[model samples]
Target: MIRHLTNGISIVFISWIVGMIINAFLIKTKRYQEKLTNLNFIKSKKINKLIGIGLIKWTVKNTFFKFFNPKLRMNNKVEPNDLNILRNEMTLAEINHLIAFIAVAIFALSMVFKGKYLPAFIMMMLNTLMNLYPSLLQQENKRRIDKLKKVFTRNHVSVTATESLNIS
Candidate 1:
């Protein structure tokens, strides 16, 4: 059972790495350039307006939570009211991880059928790492935001007073 699981895991890891490399290459080459073109020539301002409204609602919700919800507040961190936004940002990372997992599973199955163990075990670890990477990124971003907020807060008082006093 352990050997089969390991085999599945390794194949998934390799396939996932390949997928990410391909995605990076495509991004650099502007292979999906059409997406940019479509966004730029948006004919319906209605969609834009709807998006604006949605943003406003999200802002209001976030503000309410950040100011009023103690449990949601992190020390010096902006509390995101819309968890969906975080999830959306994570979607790409999740997809990459999923791809890796699938590849590993396939590889493990192959090993089981072929009576191999070492490669399968290796892939399991790799796939697990790949899938967990996105969660790491989310934590990193949170830390960065906290640091930025501290910097801005320190400067804000001086900046506001300067503006109010009409300092040239």
Candidate 2:
């Protein structure tokens, strides 16, 4: 059981590395970004809450994972350009975790076919926790960023118009 658990953990990590490599290659493509932008699996914030995404978000922020990727962190004051950069980063992260989840899931399914149910179960559980939830969390964050961007754009445009009128 220990061996199975260890192997499962190792597979999750390996899958994560593979995902990063794959995402790095794909990130430069416009089609990939467009597809990711249109991808909305969980549309409702309530559904996100129901799935315990808040817990995952809290864990990532509070744990060593926060230190692992500092780029994802946002400051108190964020401009539209900053939000655009953050949205791109979130897309990259979301795709990475999604790839990792699919890779680990495939391995787990293979283990099931081979009659190694315990290891498969362990692998799938870890994959869901490490990869799936994180991807979902990123999606949620991207949605928030999109909303914020709209607000920022609107406010900026209005402010600019007001400034122009005052100058005139």
TM-scores of all candidate predictions against the true structure: 0.34, 0.89
Give a tens-digit lDDT track for model 2, residues 101-165.
99899988998999989999998998999899988988888777777668777777322322221
Looking at candidate 2, what is the lDDT of residue 130?
A: 89
TM-score of 2: 0.89
**Top-TM-score structure, candidate number:** 2
Across 89-114, the per-residue lDDT of candidate 1 in tens digits comes to: 33334344444556556766687678
Quantify all predictions' global Cα lDDT against the true fold. Answer: 0.43, 0.80
Cα misplacement distance, residue 69 of candidate 2 (Å):
1.3
